[model samples]
Target: MTKKAQTPAVQNGNTDPNTLQLHKDPAQTDAAQIAAMALGSVAANAMTARTFAKGTFGTLDVTECVMTLKQRVDTTHDGNLKHAETTLTAQAAALDAIFNEMARRAALNMGEYLEATERYMRLALKAQGQCRATLETLAGIKNPPVIFAKQANIAHGPQQVNNDSFPSSTRIRAHARKRGTTPDELLEGPQHGSTNMDDRAATTPTRGHPAVETLEPIHWPRKPRRKSGGGA
Candidate 1:
């Protein structure tokens, strides 16, 4: 009989229990990979939360800046409108003084000039009255008021946006009709108008935004009356 060939107890890539030869179990390796993937998912969730929180803070910061700008505009317009009224009051008083002067001296030429000036003052007062009315309307708008906004969310909340917290051109118009004065003229700012006396025109004083109509100046002739007897 031929002798049977002996086979090795351990195959290649197999571990021997008594030696350092190592082998991996497929199921156990797969389980370890799954656990690693779960840990990575946890890290990714943490990163995502951080990113969202960062953007939320940025939005809050921007909202704060917008509110600050609105405050400045509010203060500026408040002071501006009040100052305009006061200045107009002074001008009206000055015109009255001129009328008193005209009454004291009886010259037809001076009377005519004074009448023209008074007409300009009346137009100014009318414009001022409109401004006052509009300002009252504007001031009536509540600031930071609780307003409802439609949104898809977990629960209903007050609107976060400030729709009219600051003045736009429309708001600055104070709801006054544009019929009397152009919106620009109604809101004549500190930056408007000429200081030079030479530039003064015999017309209704109008200083405003650049868009305001440039009215043609009326040349109210302060022409001298003719002499009873003689020559030119």
Candidate 2:
């Protein structure tokens, strides 16, 4: 008796052999897989530490070298980031060179002698785009986006935000409490007469900027209208 040929697994009732089939490699055993993963992890960690050391050698401070292991880990992180930035910049330079060469070739091919103008031109365009994208990526990697939870509020109305680390009001209040005085007095500087807390509390000092002095609204005088004469 002859063994029948087995067909590849079909998907959605289709007989296409090109369809992808997901399965573990038959040659890779459980132990082999685990060992490979462990080896990869070890290699990655070694590379990271090596890169960190290379980056930190010239710039490493005595305090950073002698401090807690956690600080060393943090320095390692900075070193790694610096390495990444350096790598990205070098890659961008390489890409720029590649793009320039490709562009030159494309320009050369566009003439009467070269037959592969379209192909070279297309490749050059692609290279230029890739170069631009890589530089953009490098820029982003160098200066990552900063998320500001609170920003300076320059607009009008009650909605205001403080961007300072320590607010002036808080500092003033703290000093006032320490010196046995009101926040208003601290703000006004050395004054002979003390201001009433009731008056200060009654007036809201421009919500966001507490240090800014509030000015009274200017009242403009209106001009009188001339009376019209009938049939002049």
TM-score for predicted model 1 compared with the true structure: 0.16
lDDT of 2 by residue, 17-94 (tens): 223222356889877765664465433454444346644443222222223333434766776566556666787777
lDDT of 2: 0.58
Runs with alpha carbons beyond 4 Å of true place in candidate 1 = 1-80, 107-232
**Candidate 1 residue-wise lDDT, 61-132, digit = tens:** 222333344454566667545544454556655655655554444343344777766665555556555556
Alpha-carbon shift of residue 103 in model 2 (angstroms): 1.6
TM-score of 2: 0.34
lDDT of each: 0.48, 0.58
For each of the candidates, the C-alpha root-mean-square deviation to the true structure, in angstroms, is 39.6, 20.6
